[model samples]
Structure formats: C-alpha cells, structure tokens
Target: MIKVVAAVIRRGQKILICRRPEGKNLAGYWEFAGGKVEEGESKRQALVRECREELGITLSVGAEIFRAVHDYPQYSVDISFFDCTICEGQPVAKEHSRIEWVGADELKDYQFCPADGDLIEILSRGQSGI
Candidate 1:
C-alpha cells in the first residue's frame, strides 16, 4: 500500500482543503492538503514536504488525528491525517485548482476525494472538535 499524509489544518472554526486541478485523475475533488509519503521518509516528513510542494507553505505538523486504509480501483492507500498549523507563508493553489477554508458542517457540500471518505464521516459524526 502507498502511504500518504494529509494535514487537518484548522484556523478558528474552519479547516483548510484544496481542489484537485483539472487533468488530474480525480479532478475537482476536494481534499485535505497533503501528498504521498516518499520512500525512506517518515509520514511527518512527507507532510511537511507536501505542504511546501503542494500548498507553497511551511507547516508545523502535529498529532495524528486519524488513520485509515482504503483500496481504490487503481491502488490501495494507508493514510494518516494529522493536526497541523501553518508556520510560514499563506497556502496558495500551486498544484491545486483552488483552496478554501471550510467549516465542518459544510464539508458535505463538496465532492471529496474517495480516500477522504472516512475522515469526512468522522467529521460529520461530530466526533472531532472541528
């Protein structure tokens, strides 16, 4: 399984999320900011790198808030969602089509990536501080 890291970056009452750019496999699907874990790198390391690469910002990665394994038609993934805060730079849509800070209750309004299904459910259940 390919390992991945997603940042649950919270600001006040909203959380950061991004939209996949067109031409990507899951174009337009919203997801938490993160990317694949590179070989020989810890999930935390990948999360930091991905935030820079994908969001053009630096992050202070925090505790892992959630973890799940899911199989897509193309491949399976083991994903860890971490609580994070921005340490530098504002998040920009460098690799994504757009970015937004969405409230927990508004999460269901967007069409999210399949890999994010579990996390979405957890947020919807009001199990998280959100």
Candidate 2:
C-alpha cells in the first residue's frame, strides 16, 4: 500500500483544498495538497514536506483528524489526514492545478476524491456538532 499524508490546513473560517492537475493520477479531482510519504519519515514529517513542496508554504502539523485505507484497481493508499496551521509563506499551486479556501458549509459543493470526500464529511460533522 502507498502511504500518503494530507493536511486539513485551516485559516480563520476556511480550509485549503486543491485541484489535481490534468494528466496526473486522479486528475481534476479536488483534494488536499499532499504526496506520498517517503521511507523513514513520520507521517507528520511527510505532510510538512509535502506542503512546502506542493504549496510553497510551511505547515505546523496538528491533530490527526482521520485515517482511511482506500483501494483502487491499480493500487491502494493508506491515507492519514491531519489538522494543520500555516507556519509561513503564502500558498501557491506549485504542484496542483489550482487552490481554494472554502468554508466548512461549502465543502459539499466540490467534487473530491473518494477518500477526501470521506474526510470532508468527518470534518463537517465535527464542526456542526461543536
């Protein structure tokens, strides 16, 4: 299984989400900015690195909000989702096609990857119940 890490990066009342670039795996689907976790690195470390590389920002990893094992026909992913805060730099689409900051209520409007859809639902539920 491929180990991946994603940040549920938040600022004020908005959460950051990115659209996958065309011609990439799961292209055009909206999801959090992240990448595969490399060998010997903790999930948090991978997430921080990925945010810097993919979004041109630094993140301070926070709580682990969700984890899911997703199976595709070609491969599988063990995805770890974390709550994060921007430590520095403005977000830029270094790897994604685009980026947007959406409010919790607006999350349902976007088309996200299956695993990410699950994550959004979990986050939305948590926010609503609080």
Candidate 3:
C-alpha cells in the first residue's frame, strides 16, 4: 500500500481543495493537496513537505482527522488526513490544475476521489469522527 498524508486546511468558513493536474493519476479529481510519505519520514513531516511542494505554503499540522484505506485496480493507498493551519505563504497550484477555497456547503459540486468524498462528507456535516 502507498502511505500518503493529506491536509484539510481550513481558514474560517473555507477549506482548501485542489484539482489534480491532467495526465496524473486520478486526474481532474478534487482533493486536499498532499503526496506520498517518503521512506523514514513521519506523516507530519511528509504532510508539511507536500504542502510546501504542491501548494507553495507552509502548514502547522493539527490533529489527525481521518484515515482511509482505498483500493484501486492498479494499487492501494493508506491515506491519513489531518486538520491544518497555514503558517506561511499563500496557496498556489504548483502541482494541481487549480485550487479553490470552498465553503463546506459548496463541496458537493466538485468530483472528489472516492476516499476523499467520504472525508468531505464528514467535514461538510461538521463531524470529524474519523
């Protein structure tokens, strides 16, 4: 399984979401910006690095909000989601096709990855039990 870390970055009433670049895996799907956890790195470390690399922002990692094990025909992912706060820089779609700060109610308009759809529902309902 591929271990990955994603940040659910919230600023007041908005949450950051990004669309995967075309030609990438799961292209065009909306997701919280993140990437694979490198060997010997902790989830938090990987998350911080990924946020910096993908979104051009630094993050203060918060609590683990969710975990999902998603299986695809080609591979599988063990994804860890965390609540996060921006520490420096603004979000830029360095790795994504687009980025948006969307309100919880507007989340349904975007097509998210299956695992991320579950997380978005949890967030939209103001329940982060996972």
Candidate 4:
C-alpha cells in the first residue's frame, strides 16, 4: 500500500481544498493538500514537504484528524489526514488547477476522490474529533 498524508488546513470556519489539474490521475477532483510519504520520512515530514511542493506554503502539521484505506484500480493507499496551520507564505496553486478556502459544510459540493468520502462527511458535519 502507498502511504500518504493530507492536511486539513483551516482558517476560522474555512478549510483549504485543492483541485487536481488536468492530465493528472484524478483530474479536477477537489481534495486536501498533501501527497505520498517518502521512504525514511515521518508522516508529518512528508506532509510539510508536500504542502510546500504542491501548494507553495509551509505547514505546521498537527493532530491526525482522520485516516482511510482505499483501493483504486491502479493501487491502494493508506492516507493519514491531519490538522494543519499555515505558518508561512500564502497558498499558491503550484501543482493544482486551483485552490479554495471553503466552509466545512461546503465540502460536499465539490467532487473528490473516493478515499476522501468518509472524511468529507465527518468534516462537513463539523466533527474533526481531534
């Protein structure tokens, strides 16, 4: 299984979400900001790195808010979702088609990867459980 990490970055009542760019595996799907965990790196480290690389922002990763194991036709993934704060720089869509700060209730309005379904429901109901 591929180990992945994602961030639930919140600003007041809003949460950050990114859209996968065209030509990507899940193009146009909205999802959290994060990526695969590299070998020898902790989940937090990978999350910070991914936020920087993909969103052009630095993150202070916090508690794990959710986790999911999902299988796509291409592969299976174990994804860890964490609460995060942006400590430096504004978010830029360096690798995504776009980025938006949406209220938790608005999450369900966007199309997302299947792996994010359960977490989206939890967050949309304002139940981070952190």
Candidate 5:
C-alpha cells in the first residue's frame, strides 16, 4: 500500500480543503491538503513538506485525528489524517485547481475521493473538531 498523509488544517470554524486539478488522478475530488509520504520521511515530515509544496505554507502538524485504508482500481492507500495549523505564509493554490475553507457541515456538499469517505463523515459529524 502507498502511504499518504493528509492535514485537517482548521481556522476558527473553517477547514482547508483542496480540489484535485484536471489531468491528475481523481481530478475534481475535494481532499485535505497533503500528499504521499516519501521514503525515509516520517508522517509529520511528509505532512509539512506536502503543505509547503502544494499550498505554499509552512505547517505545524498535530496529532493524528483519523486513519483509513482504501483500495481503488489502480492502487491502494493508507492515509493518516492529522490536525494541523499554519505556522507561516498564506495558502496558495500551487498544486490544486482550487482551495476552499469550509465548515464541517459543508463537507457533504462537495464530492470527495473514495478514500476520504470515512474521514469526511467523521469531520462532517463533528466527532473530532477536525
């Protein structure tokens, strides 16, 4: 399985989400801002690195809030969702097609990747304040 890390970066009552751009796998699906865990890197390292690369911000990664394993036709992922904070710089759409700050209740309105189903449900239900 491919190891992935995701950040649930919260600001007041809003959480950051990114839309995958066209030409990428699972394009148009909303997801937490993160990417794959590179070899020799810890999960937190990957989270911080991905946020910088994809959002152009420095991230202070927090505790793991959720985890899930999902298999798509082409691949499988073991994703760790972490509660994160922005430590420096504003978020820029460096890699995503669009970025949005949405309340937990609004999570259901957008389509998400199949792997994110459980993570979205937990967040939308206000289970962890993620």
Candidate 6:
C-alpha cells in the first residue's frame, strides 16, 4: 500500500487544491496538496516535507481531517488529509499543473482522484467536520 498525506489549506471559504502534472498518474485531476509518506518518517513529517517540496511553503500541520483507503488496479493507497496553515511562503505550482483556492461548493467542478471521492463529498456537504 502507498501511504500518502494531503493538506487542506483552508482559508475562509476556500481550500487549496492542486492538479497533477501531465504524464503522472491521475494527471489533470484535482487533489489536495501533499505527497507520498516516506519510510522512517511520521505522516506529519512527510506532510511538512511535501508541502515544502511541492508548494514551496512552510506548514504548521493541524488536526487530521479525513482518511481513506482506496484501491487502484496497479496499487492501493492510504491517504490522510489534514487541516494546515501556511507558516511562510505562498503556494506555487512547482510540481503541479496548477493550483487553485476553491470553495467547497465548487469542488465538484474539478475532476479529483478516486482516493479523494469521500472527502470531496464531505466538503461539498459542509466542511464543519474538517
């Protein structure tokens, strides 16, 4: 299974979502900002590293908001989404095709990865839980 961490960088009514770069799995699909959790590191550590590497920002990881296990033909994924606050630097699309601050109501406008289906539903319903 691939262990992954994602960030829900909530700012008022909007949350940060990123598009996978072309040529990558799930390319062109929208998803949260995070990456695979590396071996020997806690999920939080990996998330911090990912935010810096992918978004060029420092993060103050907050409470975990969601978790799901999804199966793909090639592999299985365990993804956790956490509420996060940016400590420094603005988000840049260093590794993604683009980045957007989308309102929960508009989340459905973008195609997201299957692993994010449940969380997307939750956000669409109302993000009070997160």
* Residue 114 lDDT in candidate 1: 90
> Tens digit of lDDT per residue, candidate 4, span 28-105?
999999999999999999999999999888998889988999999999999999999999999999999999999999
Error of 5 at 81 (Å): 0.3
Order of candidates by lDDT, top first?
Answer: 4, 5, 6, 1, 3, 2
lDDT of candidate 6 over 1-130, digit per residue (tens): 9999999998878899999999999899999999899889999999999999999999999999999999999999999999998999999999999999989999988999999999999999885767
What TM-score does candidate 3 get on C-alpha atoms? 0.95
Number of clashing pairs per prediction, in order: 0, 0, 0, 0, 0, 0
Candidate lDDT scores, in order, read 0.91, 0.88, 0.91, 0.94, 0.94, 0.93
- Give per-residue lDDT, candidate 2, residue 64: 83
State the lDDT of candidate 2 residue by residue for 1-130, as single tens digits: 9999999889998999999999998899999978899999999999999999999899999888788899988999999888899989999999999999998878888889987767788676655432
Q: For candidate 1, lDDT tens digit of each residue in 18-97?
A: 99999998899999999899899999999999999998899999999999898989999999999999999999999999
Among residues 3 or more apart in sequence or in different chains, the pairs in candidate 4 whose N, CA or C atoms overlap within 3 Å are none
The sequence of per-residue lDDT tens digits that candidate 3 reaches over residues 1-130 is: 9998999998998999999989998899999988899999999999999999998899999999889999988999999999999999999999999999999888989999887877888787876453
Structural RMSD, model 5: 0.9
User: Which runs in model 3 stand beyond 4 Å of their true positions?
Assistant: 128-130
- CA displacement after TM-score superposition, residue 41 of candidate 2 (Å): 0.9
Measured against the true structure, the TM-scores of the candidates, in listed sequence, are 0.95, 0.94, 0.95, 0.97, 0.97, 0.97
Please state the error at residue 21 of candidate 4 in Å. 0.4
TM-score of 5: 0.97
Model 2, which residues run further than 4 Å from truth? 126-130
